[model samples]
Target: MDKTPSSPTAVEVLTNLVADDLKAVNLAIVERMQSPVALIPQLAGHLIAAGGKRLRPMLTLASAQLLNYQGDKHIGLAACVEFIHTATLLHDDVVDESDLRRGQDSANAIWGNKPSVLVGDFLFSRSFELMVQADSLKVMEILSHASSVIAQGEVLQLITANDADTTQEAYLEVIQAKTAQLFAAACHVGGLVAGSTPEEEEALQAYGNNLGIAFQLIDDALDYSAKQAELGKAVGDDFRDGKMTLPVILAVARGDDEEKAFWKRTQEDQEFRDGDLEHALSLLNKHNTLDDTVSRARDYGNQAISVLDIFPDSPAKEALKGIVTFCIERAY
Candidate 1:
């Protein structure tokens, strides 16, 4: 239960295990992001330096390690995974008109929409270059297909946004495409580099997919959780943006007529007044949707952990299990 910042969480454990590989990935990311244009690196660097957990790239490194991979191929591939993720973040901020990212000014906020979009595209191109360097068509296909799926997921989310009538299945589809696809691909490519058996590769991809879903579900819950604000993270960004996440979806499904109207006004109509967020939080709490959302995430996390049972007991296996715990427990 190492939930506090003072205690190393599961991700930290995995990070420590793959510290050297992570360093190589970081170096590759920095080297690949450079450009004579100056603004490209500057804007991209702003977000890269903002310090995310680098979880996706870590998955790449850890999956390769789990399969006993000994080559440096995973290094460039991990960096490539990161570039795709970073590119999405830049575009996402622009689309969301978000002012802050990772607790600082977003790239779009600082550099404007045009530069953020262009730098995101630059990062994407750099990711493709790394994939080419890998020189494996399977690896290229996995990562490239993930990039496409992620784009489609973002578009799916856009279509579902501001619509209170969005179904839970649709929400799941959105997260699966936008978020889980890359997680699956990251782990899949790690095994590919190791020449893993098809079963092992499938296990890794399933593990990553379940973990990613659990991760995003917890995130959706955290958006309305009081704990988020206490931790200095913005608590109502999803609500304000009218993003139809799991908690909201659950709340809407379980709400009364009056509650439904409130959601429709705030979410569908994008209307807001003082205490609207507070009301939304209260409604979510009243329906117990936030807790239920976390419960659903725990289910996914369990599936993620079970998939790893296919692998023999090893530090890599344990670290991967810890990641599931980290993903689910972060809501606290």
Candidate 2:
């Protein structure tokens, strides 16, 4: 978890390897985002252009390429995955009332909530349209299940939002649904599209599921450790928003009666005071919870790497493996 960063990042290498294919995906994205009403594309493109890593779609491409997929169905499928992801972000920002996304004003912050939600729906319908066009029931099944699970994950998170009693297992479940499910679906569809054996498909799904969980664990840690510039959002956004991520949950579990009262006051009650964040950090450090959380992430990272053993050697395979290290290194 504390390893030095790689010289040439996995993202750089992966993007370079898939440059041509990614261009196709990008073209598909731009083409599909069009609307009779200008604002649909305007609003959707704003977030799409925001310079995030586009990690899920990359996984889709890399996984398919590893299996040596020859057709262009994956490109359109990758675009559909991006649409689902972007739509979720739009709805999430509205729900979270977030101001900044990837260091820019959130769509809801600029365009108003109604448009944000509606545009999200538009993107969702567009994703479904693409799903239908792909003409593979397997692909449709995976993405549609992922779509449903993502919504379920959001609801589960809402259920646990401010409850201090939320267990580590429960938190993992929430992330799996809201975040990892898509990652898993994206990779799984790649294998399916390549006509991989069911076991290989399952292995890819496992790789993605574990990677997605580790990815989110880092985000939970970053909410405290990363500076605003590094994270592209204000620190303590989770705390101020009363989200009970792992660090807070760890501190809550290990905190003394007084510390528990402090967390309860700020988190459960949403009554954050000036030094509350500092105190939260102190509690997290005192319990070594932050590093411990990353430690769990590392364990999952190892799982993601080991699952790739089933695949024969290829550049795409190697890059997918690099992704595990890159994900952990990013947390550092």
Task: Give the poorly placed runs of model 2, Cα more than 4 Å off.
Answer: 1-6
Best by lDDT: 1
lDDT of 1 at 198: 91
lDDT of 1 by residue, 108-205 (tens): 88889999999999999999999999999999999999999999999999999999999999999999998999999999999899988999999999
- Clashing residue pairs in candidate 1 are none
Query: What lDDT does candidate 1 reach at residue 148?
Result: 96
Give the least accurate 10-residue stretch of model 2, judged by summed lDDT: 224-233
TM-score of 1: 0.97
For all candidates, the clash counts are: 0, 0
